[model samples]
Target chain A: MKKMGKERPGQPGMDRRDFLIRLAKAGATVGVAAGVGYFLHDPFGPRASAEKPPGVLPDFIVPGVGKKIAIATGGGRIKAIDGAIEALGGMGSFIKKGDRVLMKVNCAFASPPSLCATTSPELVAEVTRLCFRAGAASVAVTDNPINDPESCFSLSGIGEAARSSGAELILPRESLFTEFTAPGSSLIRDWPVFTGAFTGVTKLIGICPVKDHHRSGASMAMKNWYGFIGGRRNIFHQNIHTFIKDLALMIKPTLVILDGTFTMVSNGPTGGSLSDLKKTETMIASTDQVAADSAGARLLGKTAKDLPFIMQAERAGVGTADFESLKPYRVSIG
Target chain B: MRRAGVLETCIGVFLLTLLAVIAGGVYWYGANPPKSASGRGPGVSGVPLGVAANLPADLAPFGREETFDPGTLSDKIDGKADLYLSTGFVELTVRRFAKKTDAKSWIELSVYQMRDSAGAFSVYSLQKRKDSKPLNLASSGGGDSAYRTADAIFFAAGPKYFEITSSAPGLMGDMKILAINLVKGQPRSGGLTIESFFPHKFLDRSTISLHMKDVFSMSGLDRVYTAVYTDRGCQVTAFISRRKSPKEAEDIAAAYGKFLLENGGVAAGEMIDAPGAKIYKVFDTYEVVMHRGAFFAGAHEVDKLESAKDVALRVYRKISEVVR
Candidate 1:
């Protein structure tokens, strides 16, 4: 009757003596774990710089140049990019002889080229050609696309652009990603970055279409740096404005080309249809990412005030949101 | 007992546990099985996403159907996944179909299964293109409505929100037919729609939308339904949100007023007709906030004071009718 009133042990291994033995086994496991931890701890040996929080990014900014922005309005992609770059002291000014350039393009989707969700293929090809012509040693095209790397590259015509131009297409893989955390960053702590593509990279150039983002107000220059992130990066979109601010701090590119040839004004970031695009017919090139996005916002019928990331980036001292403050050169194309 | 016997017993117990786990798993999965993105599932009383993914026979399947749970929803949709996740996301099933006649022609079908009818509609209305033409899907087949752009058809029926984006624009007819066929497969239910609460008088039905969270930059002020109206030469936005209690509604209304005040809004005194209603002049625009029973109502960012008051009064009376 006493046994019936009490809850019995479910198994023979859970008897009183067996329970004590299990407890002892758990204690031993803890002891072993502590011992291993103690053994691995190298107190007073190489503690200063070893296993540092950062695998630091190379300084890709074009130093010794004052902040500049150039806007080319109403022209073909080639003419606009050419005119904008010419205004900003030309491609040769940034990409020097023997300089290795990394082209960070937004191949975020594997959609049709007409959709303009990804960076234009012609833009990538043209940029690569210009970098090589500027006496660059090697110019590699890379992006950690949201879709399958091969498909995003192939269907977006970026793969063909890179292949035909002889620019190394560094497709993101698990092996290529390195965990990165920026100093004083809130969002991108211990985050995997496509760092392998940055190997021996001297100058970095950002090339992406200005599109209406459903989460962030606009996907422009700073948002393009989101491509460098890996390992389920979509989580960052929760604090999207902060994430874009972090991206601004992460990459300091030489030239950011905001392709507004046909801005995805609505249903964006992943615009499925041709109607989503509007022929804003403008190209913004800048040494400052904040200024580029600020100008790009106009194409989307938005000001810097509409996108919180613009002010956040400005507050972070990444760049100034006031494109006018930079004394921007505005040119009209035929 | 010999050491080898104890080892054998532990191994036997471990194997038994493993077998039991495997058996339990098999039974559970058999009952709630892994379904293809195109396959239909049973609906739950609460937010059942009876996903009914389909395509017309004219188009062939381009690739294998893909599915994503809440955790990996961002993988497929990227940053936009945040909006759905923050709302009431469940599962997403994606399948691409190519035109039989032309290999280059393709359409990507993204079917989002939200928590309920409200969640689905919130997503659909939130992402509705400015130039979308309304489609009568409920009359044609199932409940609720649909809209189509040049190259896409976005519609919410029951708990399922459908987005079909094609390669080219002007594929509306084909996509509409595809949407109709897809809608026919799902069970019809009048999902939780809060937009009807907004008075039809001077209300733009096309602009009627439900914002799930962070409406007007207020953190806790959520599940807000807002619509624009062309009243008195000004496009005034009328907002409404249903709270759990009358007190909660009052508190949010006050907080919204306070939020505006903190951000450079000036008190413009109370309205003449409505008691417990306040108005504010913010940056030359008029803003009004009020609450009645379990509903918080307001008008925001209106150019004209009369327009703002008119929309607010209408919304207030509309809620008063319901809660009273």
Candidate 2:
């Protein structure tokens, strides 16, 4: 209301001194903000947890006779799995009396069991029966499948096998996942692991199929542990070999079963047609996941060298790449 | 009274802008709350995926009809997601259907929608099953690239590739019905492609592969179609790629030869049938590479050099016929 740059009596219009004070206050506010921002800014977004948790998954390796391996040929899953286990000193050697066992099966897809996209229900049912036969107190069938856990479990025929075999079906829920980070590991950074399934569980067994993986070249025993991983896990496929090696380190399974009754020779991990399958007619079981996958590679018409994960896992000392060195007991089941 | 200084005025303006931004943030946060990442699981819709798929009569939906986007494609198909993503993958919808007559017998139908029909065919032909019988697709009104397996049918129509797989051996009829319905509904498409340039005689159509990038680990080789041939008990694979200019095609051809050499392939000699053709023996297999006009063509991974040269000559002749 006053003329420009003119002062009014008792109005106390903005003076140079007041302007300087206001400027100082404003400058101080911005400076403090900039200082705070400069001090707290994380240029590299979020990183792997400050400290790696000590022993994420329990080392379920049995005291002695842990690295045993067995290969069975020419049979259905029921006979093949049983023969392979028998050659590994039977379920008693791993699942003891009063032990609570967890079977991590590859029920990643909602496809039918016959498709070989998931573990065969016959194999799971037989394994559950053998676990009970070995005097296990409780056995849980669990997998954080890529699809809806319930749908994957139900459509893959694993749910009925679990329920019918008196095994608890542990479906992965939000509450079940625990953020995990492995020491000296990459790609598995503060990732959600289905840790709840391991609660009160003693022995762990991974049952997987021998199939071609478009990214990793093969989905074998070591790849089965992927089901234990949760939360936007597709990102791990970017570095699948290292991720599989990390999985090998994360889950030191008491045993791993490689189902190759019918091997997915091509278009795998999720082969959509029957022609993608070939009758390899073999099954492998081992305490050494690397060795199991090495033996299982033949089913995919490849060798350990063909799949980089096998070599990675071997280099990580998860198991021996020369599966034959284990002197795998060869069994035949009709 | 004093006029506002330039430094204070600029600071005042910035402060006002910051205040406005804060207000906008408050409004935005009030309107849209943070979502919980933990709650995200499987289905893309509010309802379960099993009931979301559209199906025809005589076949009932078996389970959720799941879908995966470019970001989530790896969730559905695992490692195979890269194959589709590299070839312009858009969306992948997977649904299973059971024969109403026999509930236990079911087939999984996965339809991968690509950016274009070429991308679709690239995926379809790339993963074409070995030893499969190429379907005339007579059941699907013809013109569709399809094949039949013991328990399934795979086809590419327009910008979508369809894979109908069944565990039951006798569900081929059910799969065919599904394929026909899907093919008819897909967008209009161009028939064949550069793939038609390959000699059909003795060529295994089902074994034809279309690699979008880094064919045989050669970065310069892209959008290549390789078809296998079985002649006189000898199995050979032939490759073809079309470029915009003849110079580009020739460069790519020579580059592939260089790539082979860098990867332990030795230059053996040249083929008399095709001028400027380079031959290489890699490990136990033979490779022949050449270009004609804007077409980059070759024969690959032949056990015998005789078969490799013969197939390369045939491919060169075929390209010449098409280029002119």
The local distance difference test score of each candidate is 0.82, 0.82
Q: Which parts of model 1 have CA positions greater than 4 angstroms off?
A: A1-50, A61-66, A96-99, A135-137, A181-190, A214-216, A238-246, A302-320, B1-54, B192-195, B243-267, B292-294, B316-324
DockQ of 2: 0.50
lDDT at B298, model 1: 86
lDDT of 2 by residue, B125-201 (tens): 87877777877664555436888877778888888887888857787776766666666546656735776788988
lDDT of 2 by residue, A1-334 (tens): 4333876685457666776777898899999989987997778764446565644678788998758888899877788888889988888988889999999999888777777989988888899999999999999998887566777788789999999999999998879887788766877777778888999999998887889888888998888888888877887888889999988988888888888999998888888666778888899898888888898888777899998998988888888999889898999876
User: Distance (Å) between predicted and true CA of B44, model 2?
Assistant: 15
What residue pairs clash in candidate 1, if any at all? B47-B115
| DockQ of each model vs. true complex | 0.34, 0.50
Error of 1 at B13 (Å): 3.4
True-vs-predicted CA distance for residue B232, candidate 2, Å: 3.9
TM-score of each: 0.81, 0.86
